[model samples]
Target: MKREEFLKRGLGSLGLFAVIPALTACLKDEVNASTNTTTSTVTSDPTTTPSSCSVTNSETEGPFPTKSPADYVIQNIVSDRKGTPLTVKIYIRNVNDSCAIIKDAIVDIWHCDAAGLYSEYGGTGMQSVNLTSVHFLRGRQSTDANGMAAWTSIYPGWYSGRAPHIHVHVYNSAGKSLLVTQIAFPEDVSKTVYAQGVYASHGQADTSNAKDNVFGDGVTNEMSTVTGNTTDGYVLTHTIFVKG
Candidate 1:
């Protein structure tokens, strides 16, 4: 199928069946860092609780080994509404092992500017916007001793067809990619944006996953998390799993 048709059908349905194995091979080059280990924890919010949807099986094991944290690059730094620079932490792990620790994983992240325009891809609708050669909103970060990596970037803006989101690529110690996913915002932002007719056609922005063809695929809520406040842009937090 053509590239446009494939994207239109969504990444999950694309016939890149053979590409999955090749993608996993690219994550073998991540560098592992040794620091004070931190325990993994989950937070609960009564207002934004996730529904009973399983995007990816948290039980699958990964295909690569772990490395050091110093070998990766951390990027996309920005300031919050309080003027405090808040760096987002990202983690690379094995797709199968829920708790398998892998260090030195390389992560490449990119997203639209504050005005909802991507840097490289064309035909996103905003043609007048000068998105070319502007890579300010993109960067790479590696995991630390605690299997956590962070980035400094501004909150992404909302577009007409989609809700606010960030794109992520997770690689292993050998620079092999393990997973490809997008992080979404909390329901609070969705409610406001949807009410304003931003994503109304998608059936209420707050409940986009159920309607968004891309998000409806193998992607899961556990793959990412949205946090911070929307009044001052937003802060999205997600962790990638790597195997050893």
Candidate 2:
């Protein structure tokens, strides 16, 4: 079955409605940044637009709501391209030192389509893959009573120029962004894609954690997973902390 279809069925079978109320209570109210010194809004061309995916202190849209992407409903399990089922568990925390532990932060995640193309971006020609009016492979889940959250999703495909990774955005109750980051897989899996010549040289397909420009920021190996090769495929676990 397609990943999207699998998620929908899984969520329905799990009775996710029973958990929505508790999850919603954990989010925080929106707050403006205290240190902003400028108020200029400029629109850039689509092709030149910067990546909205970031973990730094940047302003973003809000009203903190629960938005689940199309194929997010598998149990605490996921299957890779080879159809092996893998169990996943993610621990989330408050990473920002400025804020207190985000008691009820919200994490929104998304990724490229199975063919390794992002819906909003223009490069990938497979337009039919758009799962929703907005996009597919994207959704939101709230932190638990302990500031941790987990989900089961397939190990994403490797797109040209980038390693197999998952994109995440963290937000406080007020709908302000706390961080934007991508969790990467281990080098062995990463090298598998690179060796296939899927990405062009200009894309820096061979860059490692020490060399990748974005990952050069203050991220740690502790934030990602590197093991769990089960009969179903690989299991990837990652954790993130949000500071209120």
Candidate 3:
């Protein structure tokens, strides 16, 4: 999926809940831009957004679609797409129950490069090239037994009228789509990460989450708890709840 804005971390296991492992988030205290160092610990603090499956709001799929554009499934989708390192963690849970993880579901992710250009398509503004033969920050995968999927890509860049975000698609074993949505990041975190170069030339993001037409309603369960800095690479996590 693509957005009027742009796209789409990693996760670790914590505890047991309802016979399933409870999801926990670990965020770093600070990020050192120069050395890229950080400190982390598991936390269930109020600031963590997707700590449990509360059913994130379904979002609109933007213009560029990779379900048919992307060639296959890949775990590390950072082929020459430079920028701050970002690991995206996706947890799929059943909305009808106590957020049970849904195994065997296919998850697809796509977003702009550090320069804010999308692959497989040409555009104006920040992106001015056709990437039909190029595959940068695009990947697809199936959820593991824990109902979790992860991808290693750079932090997404901004476009117009939208905040910094990522797009996600979940498909059943039969390839039927179950969820279409996007994940958001905090404004402060975006500022800190972008300042380390890479996306600095893009200037400040033109839109805030509140001003963003897509996430303006408030990110709520769709926002991720970002830890680590651009130096140490960022680890992001979010839980997606879909109908069974």
Candidate 4:
């Protein structure tokens, strides 16, 4: 009887030893899965805000809307105006759907030169210098398949009663006005740009975004992402969503 009991006890011990390794492997696998989940969560977070697909805010076309925007449908709008070079890229998305790219949409952009002066409109109650015929810092382009229209221009300067901004007018393929908006610059970046070279002579903007007539309501949907410095120039990118 004692010998039989001993044999049974030994078998039980062997079974436990075999089962222990399997249990340990199961626990390790669970831990590995947890680690993978945490890694995925961290990687998914990005610094830039993902496009929200909401319609952009509509703004005034401003006093200096290009007289004949369709006439200047060229990519390089730099003309004779000089300042820190800026590359403007606008992405047009359809808010009526899922904010998908809207191809063949017309995008018109215009801004003041380094000295806080516009090309076409001046010499009046609004402006003092006469430049009625000169057309610079203004152009229009159709969006590509990716819904992007790009232009090579210069960093815009600020005038009194307004902050540094870019005016945009978007139209559908059939010439219907979709949205008119303005792009606001980051104050810190504008300060940095204004302190250098040609921008230095004119000084900084007199008005702040929070105090401006158009942006005072808010700039959450109109602000642009500007990268680079005064030396190498800058790139301005903004996404505009319209009903389409």
- Expressed as tens digits, the lDDT of each residue in 4-116 for candidate 1 is 23322323333322211111111111122122222223342322213332223332211111112121232532211112122356655454554544565656566554445
lDDT against the true structure, per candidate, is: 0.43, 0.41, 0.69, 0.73
1-244, model 4: which lDDT tens digit per residue? 2322322222223321111111111001111111111010111111233456688899999988887665566677777666777888888888787777888787889999878888888888767988898988887777887788888888789999999999999987766689999999888878877776677778889999999999999988788877776556677778888999
- Alpha-carbon lDDT of model 2: 0.41
Ranking by lDDT: 4, 3, 1, 2
* Candidate number with the higher TM-score (1 or 4): 4
Which tens-of-lDDT digit does each residue in 1-244 have in candidate 3?
2210111111112212121121223222243355554423332232233445566788987877674522435777777666778888887887776667787777888888766677877755445677767766777767787777888788888877778889898876555678899988878778776676667777668899898999888887678777877666788877778885
Better of 2 and 3 by TM-score: 3
lDDT of 1 at 159: 54
Better of 1 and 2 by lDDT: 1
Best by lDDT: 4
Clashes of each: 49, 21, 11, 0
The TM-score values for the models, in the order shown, are 0.55, 0.51, 0.77, 0.79
